[model samples]
Target: MNPRALRAAGPAILIVAAALTTIAALAYGGAADPLATGDPGPFVRWGLPMAKLLVNVSAAVMAGSLVLALFALKAGDREFDGALDVSSIGAAVFTVASGAVGFLTFLDSFNPELSAGPEFGAQLGRFLTEVELGRTWLMTMIAAAVVTILTFAVRSWTATLLTAILALVSLIPMATQGHSGELASHDATVTALSLHVVGAAVWLGGLVLLVVLRPVLDARRVPDVLRRYSSIALVAFVVVALSGFARTLSAISAWEQLATPYGGILCLKVAALVLMGLLGAWYRRLLIGRIDSANAARAAKAGRAFWTLIAVELAFMGIASGAAAALARTPPPATETPYSSTPAEVLTDEPLPPELTFDRWFTTWDVDLLWAFVAAAGIVFYLAGVIRMRRRGDRWPVYRTVLWVLGMLTLFWVTSGPVNAYQDYLFSLHMLGHMLLTMGIPLLLVPGAPITLALRAIEKRDDGTRGGREWIMWAVHSPFARVVTHPLVAAGIFVGSLWVFYFTDLFRWSLYDHLGHVWMVTHFLISGFLFVMSLTGIDPLPYRMPYPGRLVTLIAVMAMHAFFGVAMMMQSGLMVAEWFGAMGRTWGPTPMEDQYIGGGVAWSIGEIPTLITAIVVAVQWSRSDERQQRRSDRHADRTDDAELEAYNARLARIAERDEAADKAAR
Candidate 1:
């Protein structure tokens, strides 16, 4: 390992050790005591502490292993690098094992008294027995071990197969776990826990792999690898964030909870994430440049900075994990009677029937007209600018202006009027608004190529010297782009936002209350935008997924939505206000039917656009690869022909000169 890397590892190791010690002490000491009660429940007495200990220790170990892997990948002797690889595999196993055991232990602790009926006890027993069965962790561990073996044997196919298997196993939890309804009820905590644990594994595990492999990779190959990993990371991030948020939202009842301990902790978690993002951005912008320049000193400095930021981020994640542990144990806001209002009282006393009675045409007309005009104007202006640029042949200002205007206009139209109104509705309307904002807006706005176009436009009007525009261009093109566009990270935000809002009593409360309604609309818009942008290729991302991998991700996402719909349909009672039900008109079917259809709509229709997108991406990638291959082949052939002709011409010239010299000698 590089001497600098070794030095940097010292502080990271110390931090991990300290955190583990703290966690162990806390776990053994027992749950934090309240003034009124010494012990809250059987779960608190044993399960919570054990879970916290295991999570904290495992996370710390994972952090250390990651640092080791990064060091080995970035530096060190060839033979010694295998040690780092093994360390990563070991870290993953320990992390998964500890998490599973901790969760099971919690369940056992909860039922220590065995006070429930025999049926309940039997079910709990069955669950405990199956803890290791059909687990993604087992699959992941075996896959990692195989990859390690393959690496040593130099069997690339084996390694690839193992990686593919691991990836598939990772997808299982997204399908079977983390669904909304399951999260709202306590029955699926284990499933939710497993899904999240696996997600973290994929994310942290990939980072470890990259860090270990980076040094040996060719310079040109590094960017491509990083890009691929970025895509995976983006997806993982989305799942983590979405699932986590869903769990939190399901636990909390109203906006008032935001002021309580649970809400305060949630806010802290968010702030930590934001800070982590900022640190990541700094690494991407400042450090990445040094690494790319191949300046050893600067690269080392950047590496240290990156490691420091990641460590801090990990620590915050630990706190979030701890908070989540607490949240799972707390009673959900929905279960608590905040104002002692009965369901009958709430349903009967409302002034309105809670149905949509307004004229549909008038409600939607103005927004529709505005969007139509905006779309037409955008198309015309873009075409005109394209034609003008074609005539001028490379004049960029006109095209840039057109692109910028189109982007701004699209953003404005989506954020205003009908789209906004749809976002406020109860069910289908809200989903419709979500689709437009996330799917439609990203499609249109991403293609505008706003940053690149703006930069070219600035360059075209250079006037005298480069100054502000140059700095802006530099910043945009810098490493900072990687941080924001990191696949796992971006995906976390997208998925986490969705999970948080709906799982909490917030979902029901948001529908019935005016302020909550506004909050929901805002979050839906922002989160939807983030989700689409993370997955799609409309914008230039520092990292990108291969065509095949992206297609699989789209499939996985569709599956998740479908499962979410199914879970919703299975709910025994109404989740939303009757008036706000499907089409703003409640039908004779049970609430479960409406939910089922809602899920079906989300699942079936969402795939149509995503599949269309995937096909387009495949075609585009194939064509691009083919064109590049053709160009390369042609260039190589031309070079060969030129070399042969030159050799022959030189031989003839030499013979002619030699003959003239012979004549002069005679």
Candidate 2:
């Protein structure tokens, strides 16, 4: 296929492939089989999944195009504009597809009569207004519509990035709707599904956009673009593979269940995904370089091979999409028991954990896949940067690397180890995790100076496109960063969040909603990091407090922290009584007693990190003064003590004047 022909036929190929595969998969799996009672007919049963498949493909294109444009293409170029146009068109399709899915879902769910009458309209309205599934689709449709406009109108970097984020957020509603939220390990299921959807979209959509933009890309830029896209696809492959596996575990409990229809569809999806991954590795390793070879004949041959393989990859992606949609309709073998059996289960959707003991503290593990991924990525990227610098014979300190690695490890343990495992059941453990997230983690990470390392290690991009280094520099100097990193503002947020989060409904929200919990963790982590950065970070910042001022700020915040803990200790009524008070644990301290212990943990253990920070500030202060004195001595030595000579000459002149005045008086 030539570039022009591929550009003309790319989207058609993907859509046709997906549509045909979805129909075949649905028929084979009997996913669209008529219900024994109250069937919504073939149209609704079949149309729902078709619409859903369209939603998936369209969303991927929208998000993938924007992301690729941001990272790979230079701004103000035809290729960049073309990518955004593709994204806008994709968003429009996404909006329509989401609406179709919504209406079809209502039909499949309620089997409402097909009518134009007010009664039918009223029922439909109620579904959209009142039902959770209906609301989800409706929100998705609205968000997609908004994204469509934003993508079309915005061409600037910041605006387009925000639009892409909005586009990604639009997928969350869809991710939460499909069997994920009502299952065992609901939190993990939801997180995995969300990541899977986003990752798949980026991978699939970027490929489609590349095919479509082939004519627009300059011949010289092809290799670079291909390499960049290959990098993105590699990361997406990892995310999709891992999250898909996690989602699979949630659906199929036993290995033998692979013979079931649901499992069969899942297996097919897995095969397609794995095959696509292999194809990616092959091309990324071999074809990307050859496509831009010095030999014209070789370049032409490699280009032809690459484009042909892309068409094949699109077909495989279609198969995977079809199987996924079918699996959503098929009932899973692993259904969780009802949460109504116990108060703790009802509240958390999981049973109470084993009793909190010294041994359990070390042995218990409840991995949060999201944070684990974050920590892993952090460590990997940091190490890669350090390695890059080392290979170039640029010295990056070993201590910084060690601090960064240890910081990431600590973060993993705090979020995924025993603290996370029992935080919900025991107030004290939750407090312990909170302190670690806010203070302990930041203290370790701030000294690592990741920003400084990135600035020194990551290569600069001369192209208008933004890469890791560009983005890091932008973020560090961005106006919002300046505000947040200011010593006083950082201090205010650090101390103020403690009071505001605990006293308001925010704490309760965090206890109930996974989104809220994630937000709480992110907010506290960033706030603490900013505070520490102001005090002792080696990273460049807009402002830093004097050492004495830093100590004073720390002391003031410590006092407030202690006071807050004391208040918690003195509480007569339990906080979030409906949640913590209702957990029916057989072997733990009473709710009130646990709360008191939590207060003590916050007051005493939390303050230890603050004290350490204060000490660091004092140490830095002493070193700063010593450096100033050394500089002064070096200046005096270089000039033969010129300052002292000038002072002595002035004293001598004064004494001579005084003697002359005494002689005149005599």
By lDDT, the best candidate is 2
CA lDDT, every model vs. true structure: 0.48, 0.88
lDDT of 1 by residue, 15-59 (tens): 354345334433432233332433345444445444443443344
Q: Kindly report which residue stretches of model 1 are placed more than 4 angstroms away from their true locations once superposed.
A: 1-125, 128-182, 185-203, 210-259, 294-296, 304-311, 330-353, 357-666
Q: Which ten contiguous residues of candidate 1 have the minimum total lDDT?
A: 178-187
RMSD to true structure for each model, in Å: 16.6, 1.8
* Model 2 misplacement above 4 A: 179-185, 654-666
Instruction: Report the error of model 2 at residue 633, Å.
Output: 2.9
Lowest-scoring 10 consecutive residues by lDDT in candidate 2? 177-186
Best by TM-score: 2
